[model samples]
Target: MSVTAQCPRPESRALRENHPVMGADWGPFNVIDTAKQDWARGWAALKKFTEREAHARVPYEHKEGAYPLGQWVAEQRRAYGAGQLAGLRARRLEKLGMVWSLADERFQKNLEAAKAYYDQHWTLCAPRTETALDKPVRQWLSNLRRPGALDDHPEWKTAPEAVDKDWNPSWPADWQRHYAALRERVRDEDGPADVLPGFTVHGMDSCRS
Candidate 1:
């Protein structure tokens, strides 16, 4: 049977009230794909990455390569209030050097999980903000790492891939195959498919518990 549940919407007030660094500014990062698949994959990546990174979504307004923290904050303030501002401040806290995951067991586990996915999936680009095409992707990855308050979003636990903005791979590849399989489920029209062909819905079931 198919399942019907509401996807999490932006919780602006919760983010604003909880996050400490409310008015700070952040980056000009990016992620680019060598090619486009169905729109679903790209959208999922964008959502997943943004949620993971904790960056608020902004319209693609600035001309490429000039995603200013000040500009993003100014734009988001009208709706997101201090929550978006907090994301900016948190960006400064990002550690630039190599981080050893083994130092923390829980982090190590998460890193291992991320690495396994990274190894299994096809990531066509390195994700950089120096260029116009890759900026959004880069910022998304940055946010996922330090999601301060946005971590409360339920999608963080369910359909995690939905927010990873940097996700991109060539067509007919394994990741594309995975995406295509899931796309079929979305087409059911009435509700989400309980089991998508060729993909296993693992830990997601545990969420019901």
Candidate 2:
């Protein structure tokens, strides 16, 4: 009777531990995919906002649903400024008419308001307390007159000038207001109107020399 030697079978095992190969880990890939998805979602929300508002100058506190779209826009501007934004992403934002600088956008918006005020009143000498299109027209004008306000953006000065050549007159705003009132009265009378001293038109003493 040959006794068969019961040999314990060697345990089946890998030649090495299951260590991930270099650059083959899915952890980094998953993180990148998640970031890309988040970005795409933000882009979609911004596209909708631009389509409805006709602009991408979203307020910093604004949001779309639960998404902080305005914050995303600000991030994009920061990234672009730092040269970290991908070219394709920048182009996509530009196509949506994104305004990278809120300051510049505000200036343009105020300029439009100034133009509208001029169209209705025929002058840009609005009172300091006056508002046009919900904008502080006089205050904005006052800011524009500050030294070096337009040094870096000289082209902006031309827009107000085109709206009204005397928008930034050398004369005082009060004087211009009185003069405009007097001129309107003269035109209505179709000749020289007898505007006596202390007489007021639209709250302005137009007859005052």
Predicted structure 2: lDDT: 0.82
For model 2 the TM-score comes to 0.66
In order of appearance, the predictions have TM-scores of 0.18, 0.66
Off by over 4 Å in 1: 1-121, 130-135, 147-149, 156-209
Model 1, range 81-148, lDDT digits (tens) per residue?
A: 44533343233322211112212343334434444444433232323441222234334434554646
Clash numbers, per candidate: 24, 0
Q: Report the poorest 10 consecutive residues by lDDT, candidate 2.
A: 10-19
Error of 2 at 204 (Å): 3.1
Candidate 2, 89-186: lDDT as tens digits: 88899999988777788888999999888876778888877888999999999888888889998768788888878777888878887887777767
